[model samples]
Target: MAAERVEKRGEEEAQTRLPDLSFVHDKLQKFQSKMVSDFEQRLSCMVEDVLQDLRQRELRAHEFPNFEKSDRKSTWHNRVTNQAPADVSDAPNGHANGTQPRPPLQSETSVRKQRRQLPEKVFVARESYLTALLQVEHMRTIYHIFYIILVMFLLNVICYDYFVDGRFDLGLGTFRGGLRRLHWVLGVWLLEHVFVLALYFAFRGWALVRHRLKPHSSLQRFWSHSCLILYISSQLVFCFVSTSLCLKFNLPFVSACVLLLESTRLLMKMHAFVRYNAERVLNGKAKKEDAQEEKEASGRPFVPPLSCYTYFLFAPTLIYRDSYPRTSHIRWKFALNRLLEVVAIAFLYAFIHERHIHEHFGQYGLEPMGPSQLILKLFGMMLPCAVIFLCGFYLILHSWLNFTSELLRFGDRMFYKDWWTSHTYDGYYRNWNVVVHDWLYEYVYKDMYTHVFRGSKVGASLAVFMISAVVHEQVLGFALQMFFPVMFFLFGVVGVALVFLMRSAPKVMGNIFLWFSLILGNATLISLYAMEHYALKNCSLSNRSWTDRLLPAVWRCYN
Candidate 1:
């Protein structure tokens, strides 16, 4: 019996070591059956391992920042989403998705205190409308007409120079002079980029340090608030220091404009980064303490990669995200055409300035003018200003933005909507410059409504207008080295009033009214700014004082 049991165990071991091919008649068939069995077992194990890895990755992807509630798919393209419908548009109030509803008021007098989540900005592959439209024959004619106008302006310049000066001249001296100190502008921009890069690393380090601290402890809260104070102080210092340097070095108008504009851009980028991540950093403990919250926060990044932060600093949109929709390949031809358009439009501006603006207002403050002359000047400036308005729209919003987007291979092409079709100021404001509008709406308007004003819609709207007005005024005022608040009054007061008044206007009337207002407003703006610019140069200061800089000197010039 012992011998039989030992023999049985030895036979079991031998059978486990190798599969039997007893039915095969040839050596090749025996080898093939053995190989097939071994391959089947290995394949099954590999598939199981792959499926387990995929499950882990899926869990990581579901984790969202504290600010976002649901991860909806982009309206423009198909990437993975939370099974949201593709047909719906992004509505501000969150009604389109039917997921979030407006909260009820707390009491008869009190408003809702709960914060509303903003709709995520979607990115998809698309071409700018004008870029596509110009490809058609009818739309191409308008482009040709503009080209012809450019040629006519060039001819007029050459003819006038030949006749008056007895030599051909392009008269680009002013244009060239205005663009001086370009190298200084470039240097400043380089430094600004470097500073922002350092700022990102600083933020990343703080996040890591904070992550290790006891969640919701006094030390954690202290560091969080201290970081906030430091960030605000540093940004203010940077702004003031850069502007002061511009004044101290006496940078030209164009250089000052570039530097200041860039300073504002970086400031916005930094704020967006900080504000978007505020919840995650502050609520780190919630993930660990609560089981439900832990499921959502598990595998989510504590701090986003440096690469993502760096990309946000330069991306066309002010709003930041981990990733954006991207194109499969770059359209080199389209990029080249956009580049050419930018150059052509720049020359068009110079020509318009020389023939229309400079001829009428170049010597503005040097001579006395009657009220009739002033009215005539404003009207005459209207057509040229309209041209300028169109040129600027195409140059920056379409050409320049498209160029950068193409280079980045960014898929979102809806930078600006069909703002021209809008009948009301509200629609116009939202459609025109969709890039900047998104940032303001998300960070400024939404935050105020959710946290500060307690869902007071009117108060939130007013706050948005105030913030925009101030920023606009700051850019224009600082660049021009004056304290005139014409932009502030126009944007905050007059523009807001128009938005309300035009609400009831008829479609046909509204369209006409919108155009009329735009032309008139732009004309007044250009005329006043130009007059003041030349006035400061030509008019003598009685006593050099702050009042002289703050007050309009056009009156002095006329006196």
Candidate 2:
């Protein structure tokens, strides 16, 4: 009876421990398999890389025969001497000690040396013929046409305002109102600089602290993480405060837009700075293991130069680099031309807003509308809307950015590519805003592809589009003080679909499609938004319902 009880107890204990042991065994097996797979993949990549190096060497040899021969001879002699056995000697008959000579073996160092000797390929910005034409003296006669048309429009607007309103004002009342709000705008601008300067100093101080600490220690890592969180939190607080002030003060639309845009840019700069430095620190740590030199592993934390950071704040780029290609001198005449163009375009925008946009859509719900009337209204607004769109693009992306770049002598003038002539929607998106696109590509797309989606290009692409669309919609919605999702839908859905479709189409057809889509999309946005904006102002609702307030007024203007 005692033996039976002892046996039963033993059996129960064995059964209880079996599952735990098996679970651990299963985990180990999985880990082993993963390690093997990763090792195989790495080995395969290394082999491929070596093969590619050989092929490139062959191509270079064909292109430069004399240089290639000299390189080959030197490499062969080094290999033969270094690797040859002490007993073996070179014979006159190309033999070693009466035996056939061994073949020359390429060393990893020699391959690296060859790679280092290869010339680096330089990238040049490709501008369209039209952009180049704008620089020519004779072609610049085209500017006078726009100037003449602008003057005529101004005259007509002045006459209409004076005759209709019995006032000789050129909308100076709005200008004066904006000026009154200018002090608030300047205050917010100053606050942003203060926040940025504080963040920079914080980073510098943390770097100094890190340099004094032991590498990879728990205390050091904890402090580093704490500082990172603090910097990010501070930036978030700054953005929140800045945005609240802009909304609270009811700043001018353009002024609010500029403030928000600059705030976003500063945040981007901080992110870039942190990301770049973090990578450099990680790389430094990684190289330390294989460095074999005391100088290479001196244990100093990576800290970016203050001047580089300052320059990046003013530079027309999102990417952070220690330095950039620069021109020797500023082009004063070109800078002046661009600045003047920006001012002229600003006035042109104001005139359009005062005359055409307001006149057509100011009384949307006051009048009964038929389909024909709506169609005519949209058609009439299309040309003016297109002109506004083009002028805004030229003013900001080309004129303003280029002017700043020239003043700083920044050499990368390709702020935008030839987006006007882009054959595909994907191409257009890439070329339209190279600065923003680079940020998205590096941080969003690449990060998603690497970490989240794990190499799913489609998933990564979708993430990028979603992020871009949301940011764009946020900008427009906040600036306009409206909750319209028209731009969001167009950007995220229609634009993405067009990217895929236009990707495979022929150049001519794709370009035509691109332009047609642009025209239609811009027209639709202007028409719908304008109608809704005016309807909200002019229409009086019978019942103050949630639907009436939340939904677009264009849908129920008659109600």
Candidate 3:
């Protein structure tokens, strides 16, 4: 009996160790059965990406057919969306058996590209045009544009301040003498308009590309937000630190520029509150609806938004007063907070004024500087003196830059209460506050995009962008403003927000239009603001009275 038990155990062990012929046969058969689809599906993604890189590089039509892609698909090709090639078009869905003839995949070295993923790999593009752009095989070439622009600005500033001084010489001569003055105006304009929003916009793009690459896992998003935070924070630290250092002591322009470029690591600390809020809003809505359905079976209340169109009646309530945290909800809090912020600001300013007012009487403020002088003063405040660089940094570290918060607050409310505020909705947070608006788009909008628009990534991507631009404009004003910033910011933000629009309804489609209005209105408003600031700043010289300054600022609307 012992020998028989040993023999049975040995036979069972042998059976377990042996490969299963039947299982292998089943797998091989299944693979062969789906071989066409597997081959075509992969080929579809590859071919689409290759052709897309071609079309983007503006390669002339090759052997590929001029098939009619959806309008949204064409737009996706134009816009900077991070969607898979197959997902962008219907080519894969229509793919049939061996009889079906599809576009041949190009093998150009420049045409190849690997999607932007964290675990990186070098791409071998098939085409030469893109090959030059991506010689090292990286993500999109837009970064090159930013790099070139930065270099040009610095060079122009350097040449103007040191060399040109006013010589009608050749090459960079014209730009040399005028550089300082131009820098005064341009710097003021940039500090006012571009600097604060630059990183936020860039992060919007980074987030989109990340969403495209990673279709699964929520935790990986931490890496995405981290990348954004790094990029943005780099800009702020580099600019502030460099300027703070340079103005105090004369550092070589080369050293300053190099330091600014390198040390300015990317850091985008965009808010996650928006995403969490949207998630809760959406999840809560669905769960409530589900519970309501169950309760209805037990005879409970049923509430609909009256009619599809009538939903607008509840729009304000839905966005502002819902249990959810919304822009409107935040704005009211911000407004009240800003009021206290103003009082604190005024107290601080007044304390400084009282001290300085005794030394220079009423001239303690920027009274010595005329309008242009005031700009120079503001410009000086924005940048740091090489000598006082550390002092100022330390001071700001301790005291919040003395008066900057108040100044920004004063300016913000002034602008908000001006003629433009009527053109927009009541609350600043709803969308006017670009900072928080970007936060909403990234966290809230992006979540919806990845989950809802699983199949048609590109269309959903562009729609959200377009919608954001259009709505922001209509609400902000189309007749007065240009739409690029609104477009740029909204495209970035809405592209962010609409990432969720896939599972969203046409009502939810309102995000698109809101973004549109934001794009048009804000772009125009800011453009008008900066141009007016530059054009009429001199007007203050002619008139110091309230009406003089106010009139000139208003007249800037025309030119």
Candidate 4:
């Protein structure tokens, strides 16, 4: 009885020492709840203060437009302009570079319209998709696989030459042959650049002449008309001269390709420069009363620096702006890598043509084949042609453009998008070459819709398609020295039809169809063009006339 009583007393003492456990737990919970409530109250106050500050800033943005110089350049999505602000020190009558005065912001609708008409381009600091993707291990592996395939192709060429002739050879004869007359290509390109540069000074001189003359004076009017005539005549003459030189010089196919492509780029750049500045020149004439005010507002004359014009000529863009987002410094290593890829891809093209394209089609005109054999040839060419197409994309759009952009310290590097994943033709066309598509959209499609087609979207879209088709055909025709409308038919007719048909297709089905069409179309292009090229060489025409030159040589080969 004594021992049990002692144990009971010990337990009672321990419980007293522990204090009230439940009371302590309740107190802690109350403390946590109070802390949370206090935090919530403080956070709410902070958020409210931030909101008030934002509201004030927005109000100021509206009340004092001068505060928007920097913001205005960046506020719009994918749209930016290099025009001076309204309060700039040297704008002719408070206008930017003598640009037409902004209309009164009388209504919301008009404001929206004005916004739509703003320049539709923005340059932001960005790396290309492939450059970013290649940083990841898995994506880098895919790129490595392409290099491996190219190496395998080279080995195959070596083995073939060794087995046939009992001597090792690189089998690059066809490639070397095609790249002949490179010096001529370079010469023509240099000459074209000289002409393009001349245009800038010519326009600047005319602007100065106009700037000095009295506004609305008869002499100014005559000079303005003369300037218009000069622009038109110069452009036409440049086009004629460049094209005739390409044709008359009897340049090699590759030389012609370079000249033709460069010519198109120069023409587009020239037009963009003129079209943009012409508005500014005309605005000065229209707003003569505001000229003094603009001069007072701006610190200097409104002419763009020659450096800006020269930069645009080599920059990986077609749009003309006085300023663009730029990097702090050029990445020489990055530029070197891109240039190396260009060289490698050029070799890849030559190998593909020699092995798969030229070998099969070289004897096309000399030999006869049945329909089944022809179909087999067509199918066989599909994979090779698809590879060539992808290489070509990388060569011109990615590698070449990126090299130039890096060298120039251009910030916007989005020369293409994820076109391979596109499920619709419309998406593919838009994403394929963003640089060109942007030019077409801003200058061609929008202008047609607003001014020419009068709000007819269909007409504008059609115009865009037609222009693209014709230009594509022209390039190929000049390169091959033959007239073939296969590209035109595929691009303008079947491509458009597929776009509408696949507009709402299921994602899986649409993507499959898109790839199928691309492969098949590339196959068709390579086969037909190759056959025609060989046909012209191997087959003799009884009468070599201008019309005969336009006729399909492949048909004559069979006849």
On lDDT, the leading prediction is 4
TM-score of each: 0.77, 0.72, 0.22, 0.77
lDDT of each residue in 1-559, candidate 1, tens digit only: 9999999999898887555443334677879899999899788767875886587556434532211223422332222222221233333222232233334545633332122333445455555667655655666899999889778878887887789778865756655776778788788889888888888888877887777777789998898789889988999988887788677767777678888888998989988887776656665523254777568766343666788898788778887765666666778998998899898877777777777887778887777688998999999999889989888898888998899988887766768876897789988998888888888887898789889998798899899999899988888877888767888999999999998999876555787899999999999998888888787877775758866666687777766
Local distance difference test values of all predictions, in order? 0.75, 0.72, 0.35, 0.78
What local lDDT does model 3 show for residue 162? 53
Model 1 quality (TM-score):
0.77
Task: Output the TM-score of candidate 2.
Answer: 0.72
Error of 4 at 298 (Å): 8.6
Give the range where candidate 1 is weakest over 10 consecutive residues by summed lDDT. Answer: 76-85
**Which regions of candidate 3 deviate over 4 angstroms?**
1-168, 171-174, 177-445, 448-534, 541-559
**Model 2 worst lDDT window (10 residues):** 118-127
Instruction: Measure candidate 2: CA RMSD.
Output: 17.3
Indicate the TM-score of model 4: 0.77
Tens digits of per-residue lDDT for model 2, 288-402: 4455644764766656668888998898888776665566677799899889989788777777878888778888898889888888888888888888877777888888988
Alpha-carbon error at 360 in model 2, in Å?
0.9
Per-model root-mean-square deviation over C-alphas:
25.9, 17.3, 28.8, 17.7
Candidate 1's C-alpha runs over 4 A off are 1-117, 167-171, 285-301
Candidates 1 and 3, the one with greater lDDT: 1
Q: What's each prediction's clash count?
A: 0, 0, 58, 14
Our model 1 lands, by Cα RMSD against the true structure, at 25.9
When sorted by TM-score, best at the front, the candidate numbers are 4, 1, 2, 3
